[model samples]
Structures are given as structure tokens and as C-alpha cells.
Target: MPEPAWRNEGTEPDYRFTLANERTFLAWIRTALALLAGGVLLHQFATELDPRIVVTVLSAGLGVVAAVLSVVSYTRWRANEIAIRQGRPLPFSWVLPALAAVCLLTSAVLVVLLLIA
Candidate 1:
């Protein structure tokens, strides 16, 4: 029988690692969907607010960030999987910090808009 791609010579396959990566990707996608939904709600339901500008800006920003993160998440997962298969160290340092910063910025913007609205 041919060895599974996730298994290396003389070692059991790491299904845990593959499953964890899949879970992380799904989490990112779910987060992106939530952000998109929030944007849609803000644009459609918050029409009576005094500061439409802030709401609109925040919603648009969140949607764009979510979309970007979704793409980044998928790309990162693929890269990490490839690296693991090839016995190379995973590339995670850059993506982690960037994603954190994006979330922080989005939260701060949302807070500011809420305070002012």
C-alpha cells in the first residue's frame, strides 16, 4: 500500500496537526463571515444614526479586513502544510502579528464609533 502523504517514513501520520490546521482555517472563515455580517447590519440597520460617516467607514473597513484575512488565512494554511510535508519550519510569525494588529485596530475603530454615535 502507498503511504499517505501526511505520513513520513517510519512514522505515523499526524492527523492532529492536519485537523488543527483545518480548524484554524475554519475559525478564520467564520470570523470573516461575522465581520461581513456586522458590516451589512451596520449599513442597513444603523441608518438613523447621527454619524453615518463613522459607521459607514467602520463597516467598510471591517469588511475589507475580513476579506483580506480570509485570503491570508487560506494562503498561510497551504504554506504551512507544504512546509510540514517538506520538513521545513512553519512560517507563522509574520502572519500572527499582522492579524492581531488588524483585529486590534478594528476593535478600536468600532469602540470609537460606538462612543461617538
Candidate 2:
């Protein structure tokens, strides 16, 4: 029989790790959807009829970042799961911090725009 991709030569596969990775991917997807919803809300309800340039820029930037993060997170999670199964060191955990920074910066920009406009 062909060996499972996650199974190593002698060690038992870690199903828990695999499941956790899957969960992480789902969470990223949720985050992306939330960002998209927020952008839609800003475009539809929050912004003025014409919409400020900053508002449109920030919303579009956030939506793009979230979508990119979703793809990156899923790919990284799969790679990490495969690495763990193969007894290799996992990749760095940078996505969360990057996402957080994007959110913070975007919020700051929005606040500044609101105050000025």
C-alpha cells in the first residue's frame, strides 16, 4: 500500500497537529471574510455619498491585505503540517503579527482622516 503523505518512516503521524493547522486556515478565511464585510460596510454605509479618498484607499487596502493573508495562511499551514509530519522545523510565525500591524495602521489612518475631514 502507498504510504500516507503525512506518515514518516517509523513515527506515527500527528493527527492533532494536522487538525490544528486546518483550523488555523479556517480562522484566516474567517478573518478575510470579516475584512471584506467591513470594507463593504464602509463603502455602503459609513462613507459619505462621494466617499473620501482616504476612506476608499484604506478600505481597498485592507481588503487586499486580508485576501492576500488568507492565501498565504492556507499555504503556510499546509507547508507547516507537511514539515511537522516529516520531522522538519516549521516555518516562522509572522503572518499574525503582519496582519495585526496592518489593522493597527489602517485604523490609525482612518482615525486621522476622520479627524481632519
- What is the lDDT for 62 in model 2? 73
- Measured with C-alpha atoms, the lDDT of residue 83 in candidate 1 is 67
Q: What does candidate 2's lDDT look like per residue over 1-117, in tens digits?
A: 996565554354578877887898888888998988888777666565333766787778878987897889778877777777678888888888988998899888777766766
Candidate 1 local lDDT, 1-117, one digit each (tens): 996464453333277877887898898798889878988888888786657887788789878978987898888777767666666778854766776787787678767766777
Q: What is the RMSD of candidate 2? A: 3.4
Query: Which candidate has the highest lDDT of all?
Result: 2
lDDT of each model, Cα atoms only? 0.76, 0.77
Question: What's the TM-score of every candidate structure?
Answer: 0.73, 0.81
Q: Residue 14 in candidate 2 has what lDDT?
A: 71
Off by over 4 Å in 1: 1-13
Supply the TM-score for candidate 1. Answer: 0.73
